[model samples]
Target: MRNNLHSRKINFVQDFLRIQNEAVIRRFEDMLRQEQLKLAEADLSYPMSLEELNTVIDQAEKDDRNGRLTNADDLKKEIDNWE
Candidate 1:
């Protein structure tokens, strides 16, 4: 048997996808479809609306300045609590 790099790569990806549970693959496909739709409708030349994004950035900066942030321990604890 001879090995081809492109074929090997394709087989690896196919195996990876096959190993994923059906429900996970379906959900991933749905997310990919949604992202494709978003890209299709996106306007590259459109100016960004700063009002909402600026507010979010300002809030994040304020939190950082005030030391209102989580440490690794806090993040681990939060993840542990997740359902």
Candidate 2:
């Protein structure tokens, strides 16, 4: 399976390098960008691992102990004064 994938990637790079049309290259660039954006959005929706969740919770606990949080009433009042 690894060898098959390696050969496919090699062939794709060869084919991609032979392209002479500017518009076709731009289309491939656009498609690659769209796929990357979709992958990023998908990454955001997955649950974090236990260690990651714990790290976030730890940070929040430290922040709370240090009085880094604001209450809802203060937040609403601050937002109301925003330009």
Candidate 3:
């Protein structure tokens, strides 16, 4: 019974270390990607402020609730008619 408990503790420690290593690797990969993007001169635009995003979302929800938004198929049909 004591041996079994010791084995379980070892297994738990191994699992913990594995997860920690994986997290560190993921962070390293992310840093590398960011560095590559910087080297490539990618335009890293800042996202809209929370208030601005909230306003956009609110407007979209309102339009959806009021049936002001067109369905994809319907919009396509309308465009076809125009053509």
Candidate 4:
């Protein structure tokens, strides 16, 4: 599923890059923004269960132990280089 999602993302970028119509580009941008807003709102609407909270904590602890963590400054620097 992850691979499929990644491939779909690449295809979407390819499709987006081929677009030349200004109106179509504006519509795509609006739709994408709306979908992202819906996703964010949905996340905030959910109250985490005790089990879910514990799972998140466990993942963080594992990440810490495995040294799979990024500090805020490093993350911000990385984000600045993103397209």
Candidate 5:
């Protein structure tokens, strides 16, 4: 019974793929790439101690309150000016 149910699920997926248009296939490919990127990033991450995490979060909040964040475009322009 389990094997029959699994085979039906696989057949449904195969049938769906067979009918998808080029645009739909491209969208699926893009989604798959995004998922792969997320998986790769997950593999590189390590857990931090609670104290260290809290310290980092506190520093971020402090920076936000102090208006210490730089705009991405402004930072890019500044770097270009350096060169």
Candidate 6:
């Protein structure tokens, strides 16, 4: 049952990707890149003290509330312009 569900999910993703235009696929890739960067940054900060981690989390919340974060699409455009 677990394998069947996994297979179905994989098939669904495959079908979705097959129908997406190049621009949509590129946008999806950019989103994945942004997520990868966030994960990498989190991983690098793994050795932080509890207080430091809490401070970092609080700062992230503040930035989010203040609209200080860049969206994946804008980041991708900025990166592309750098090339």
Q: Give the poorly placed runs of model 3, Cα more than 4 Å off.
A: 1-46
**Candidate 3 lDDT, 1-83, residue by residue in tens:** 99999999899677656775777778867988999989666544666789988999999999999999999999999999994
Clashing pairs in 5: none
Each model's C-alpha lDDT? Answer: 0.83, 0.98, 0.85, 0.98, 0.89, 0.91
Residue pair clashes in candidate 4 = none
Q: Which 10-residue window of candidate 4 scores lowest in summed lDDT? A: 40-49
Question: Residue 70, candidate 5: how far off, in angstroms?
Answer: 0.8
Which residue pairs overlap in candidate 3's backbone?
Answer: none
Stretches of candidate 6 off by over 4 Å are 1-46
- Backbone collision count in every prediction? 0, 0, 0, 0, 0, 0
TM-score of each: 0.33, 0.60, 0.44, 0.63, 0.40, 0.43
Ranking by TM-score: 4, 2, 3, 6, 5, 1
lDDT of 3: 0.85
Model 4 global lDDT (CA atoms, 0 to 1): 0.98
Give candidate 6's error at residue 3 in angstroms: 64
Comparing 5 and 6 on TM-score, the stronger one: 6
Tens-digit lDDT string for candidate 4 (15-60): 9999999999999999999999999999999989999999999999
- Local error of candidate 3 at residue 61 (angstroms): 0.4
Per-residue error (Å), model 5, residue 23: 52
Task: Kindly indicate the candidate among 1 and 2 with the higher TM-score.
Answer: 2
Which residue ranges in model 1 land beyond 4 Å of their true spot? 1-48, 81-83
